[model samples]
Target: MKQHFFVLAALCFAACSKEPVLPANIPTDNPALPANSFTTFNIAKGNHYCDKTAVHVFSDSSMSVKVRFDSSCIYKTIDPGNQDDINKLVGFTEGNNNHLHSARFGWRWSDNALRLFAYSYAAGVRSSKEIATLAIGQEAKLRISLLPTEYVFAVDDTVVTLPRALRSGIANGYWQYPYFGGDEVAPHEIIIEIEEI
Candidate 1:
């Protein structure tokens, strides 16, 4: 009787453990719409980061989204050349910055069950930050998929559509605002991308 009870408990636990819950507003069959529509950010550009920074803006009125690094490399005065520095750099932020490194993904109000995958990296780990924002607001519904091994973010229709992949990791969001140089020095390499779903 004891053995049977333990087996049942294990089975129950396994069954209950499933993927995280996605928003109910999205469709299961075609979660992403308007397949190939997207935009990108190149860190080489200027003044992309600052206090109250706004990255990308969606055309859909239902949602307004933005992505910011929000971390201060100026204060730390430490180039993220090692894991310890990388950890320290990532530790100082709140919200999604702690979990997201090189990538920033967001959806608008109309976006229901849509998924946004960002390919990013920590400061000391890779080069420039790259992003892909997918807008799936049409009937066909688009899907944005991540291939980690190949380092690719794609929109899938009949075939696996690949976008330009930058390094992948988390974005540290601690250094935003007056703390990042006290209104004297502005943030650098702050990349932002936007999409609609």
Candidate 2:
């Protein structure tokens, strides 16, 4: 009888002392980059990291979800060689070779606000555009969908359209994983939550 009571108490303690579980951190070689040493991408709900970061690439299908991130803005000029200093945090993607990727999508902060952008590389040059804007921290439901003809941003039901690209068409390709970035390390952790739709 004493043994049974002790076993029951031990089981109760084990059940009550379970630790909080978090989503797995991305692998060191997260497959998003061709080179190593840029292992700063986290795959949880909210992530706040500074210093020109990128999430793993979602090389599957299009996704529409509710995303949340604080408007912690930092400015840095991107050096083309240091893969660590890229300016883009998220976009649609094509091209599986080298550093030459063509992507068009939105939701990066700049000028004290959030902006939409599209990028493509060709002829030894890269073409990028900051197409539109949104108010930060506004609980916006963002949708980045590639149509048969154009790249579209539907934020809370308002539509903004953009060109596809020369090297990689942003229509129906893989979505580049989300990114958190800046010139220096984040003053504080910057967490962004992406809720599946």
C-alpha local distance difference test of each model? 0.28, 0.47
Q: What is the lDDT for 106 in model 2?
A: 36
The regions of model 2 sitting more than 4 angstroms off are: 1-61, 71-89, 97-101, 104-111, 116-136, 165-175, 181-187
Per residue, candidate 2 scores C-alpha lDDT tens digits across 128-155 of 5555565555555556555544456566
TM-score of 2: 0.47
> Candidate 1: which stretches are off by over 4 Å?
1-47, 50-100, 104-119, 122-124, 128-144, 148-150, 154-194
Question: For this target, which candidate reaches the highest TM-score against the unseen true structure?
Answer: 2
Error of 1 at 134 (Å): 16
* Residue pairs that clash (backbone atoms under 3 angstroms), model 2: 47-190, 47-191, 47-192, 48-190, 48-191, 52-182
